[model samples]
Structure formats: structure tokens, C-alpha cells
Target: MKGKDKCKALKEIRAKIAEENDIEYVVSECKHKGDCKGTCPKCEAELIYLEKELEKRRSLGKRVCVTGLAVGMAATVAGCTPASVIDPIVEFFGGGIGTEDLAGAAQPPEPVMGEVEPPIETLDGEVEYVPDSENSSEEDCSGEDCSEENGSEENGSEDPNGGSEDGKGDNDIPDLAGEALPPEEF
Candidate 1:
């Protein structure tokens, strides 16, 4: 329902209640008549009066369902269209119309997932491994620090053959007494 329709419906309900209680119903013209937000003095007074009458009816043990009327009036007072108020209630009761009403304006667009291609296939039904040159820049190292030259004596080893006396030129392993564990443990 639009604002006008909601206002009309509220007026009809108010009239019906007034007629049932022997109260005279008067229709006053409002400046915002067609697009009444129910904030105007006339509409606010009518809603308050109607609420009071409903409270009286409830106090007298009369069963009155004020849910629809109250919500409609509240929505109008808050300057919201009736559809914005009613759509969620209709949806809560399993009505599918709400999604249609809320589709474009009220909802956010869905997220998109990137597509990944499979590895290259080979004739033997196995994925072929092609090493990329940009990803393979590993340098060969033989000592604790790759920055050290092969014949450097900074390690306090006087023997020039990497602390090895065997003329076969085999490098001797350094003392690991105070050294950290190898990277494989990590």
C-alpha cells in the first residue's frame, strides 16, 4: 500500500470504531492530505485518540486487534511508505511477495568468485610440471652463511681447507654446540 492508501484505510478504521462507540466522526482537510505522513497535528491527534479508545476497550475486557492499525499508523508517523513496513511482516509469514518488492533497491548484489584453470595435461594422463624461471632463483650454498667466500678464515679456523686436514678438500662441519637447530625442525 502507498501512503495515500494507508491513510485512507486508517481513516476508515477510525470511522468504523467511532460509529460503533456512538462518537461523531469528523473529516478535517489537511495541507498534506494526499501524502499525509501522520505527523501533522490532525493525524497525530486522531492516532492518539484512537489509541486511547482502543486502550479503553481493552480495559473493559473487549478483544481488539490493534497490530495492523498500530503498525500502519506508526509507519506513517515515521514517514515510511506502507510497503516498507508490511513487506517484512508478509515475508515473516512465508509470503514470497516481499523479495520481489525488495529485490533491486533494498538488497546488495552477490559476490563474484574467480575461476581457476586446471594444471596443464600431458600425454601420460599426468599433470606436467613446468618450472617458471622467475620462481627459481635459488643460490648454491655450502657453509653457514652463503655471503662468506670459500677460503675466508673469519670463522677462526686457521686450516685453509675449510677446517679439514684431509687433502680431498672435503669441508668440515662446524660445531653445533651453541647453534640453532636446522631449518627442517621448523
Candidate 2:
């Protein structure tokens, strides 16, 4: 072969080798860049799969952030509403609602001085009254007399045989005091 023709043939063979190795070089470069714009069919498939995964992750992140914001705004609005706002509406309905009606009614009743209204009693029959003059007045008795009277009333009502008024054994008193006493010797 002629020298020029031989050189041309060698150059053509090198060019073919370089063309074959180009795919490998492109892949290496793409890997170094942390992403791939794959030129070959296999690498392009991998890159498409990765892009789909990244898109799914981004959508999930957006959904979570939006949901969190919605929940936070709802909580903030709920907390901001005045506790007193419901009171007037409840009171205007004749004061027979929940705690709101009671709280509203409580303020007005407190300020009106004198002539305090008596508590409504729930007894079935007409109330009986023992007059102050008829009842024993605490002012007439000394402190000692009052104490003795109270003590006598309690002790006199108690049964002597360690039993109650209903003739049942007294469950409240322990047997320890009786156990501690020595037996009587003749």
C-alpha cells in the first residue's frame, strides 16, 4: 500500500473506535453532573424513570405543605373567636342555655345591690318555719354549756351495746379498744 493511503486507513479505524466509545464518555460526564440528558436508548430510559420519580416527590411535597397550611389557618381562626360573643344570643333566649347563658346572666345579677333574691327551693310542699324566738338561741348559752349540750346529744343518741339506733353492730368503731383492756379478775 502507499504511505498516504495507509495513514488514511489508520485514521478511519481510530475514528470508528472513538464513535463507539462516545456513549461511555457521555454517560460518565452525565453521572459527574448529578443528572443525565441521556443520548443512548438505555440511558435515556433510566433518565426518564428518574424524572418521573422526582416529579412524584415534588407533588407529594406540595400536597403536604398545602394541607399543613390549611390546618394551621383553621386552628388559628378557631382560637381567635371571642369567648364572650355567644353569651348575648344565649341570654336573649330567656337564660336557659348552657354555661354561656349562665355566664351572661351572672354579670347583671352581681351589680344590683340590696334586695337579693332568695334561692329557689325545689321542695315539694309548703316550707315550714321554726321561728327564731321558739328555737334555742346560741347567744343565751355560754361556750362551755353549748359544748356540753352538743356532746350529751351525741353520746345519749349512741347505743350502749356498741350497736346503732337501728340495732345493727356499729361498723365505724374498731374492736381494738376492747382488745387492749385487761380481763376483770374476781
TM-scores, all models, native as reference: 0.28, 0.14
Per-residue lDDT over 37-120 for candidate 2, one digit per residue giving the tens place of the 0 to 100 score: 112233333333322322332322211111121232112222444766668766677563222233343312221234453332
Task: Give the Cα-based TM-score of candidate 1 against the true structure.
Answer: 0.28
Local accuracy by lDDT, each model: 0.40, 0.30
What residue pairs are clashing in model 1?
Answer: none
Tell me how far the alpha carbon of residue 81 in candidate 1 is from the true structure, in angstroms, after superposition: 20
Least accurate stretch of 10 residues (summed lDDT) in model 2?
Answer: 61-70
Winner by lDDT: 1
Q: Given candidate 2, what's the lDDT at residue 87?
A: 82
* RMSD to truth, every model: 39.1, 48.3
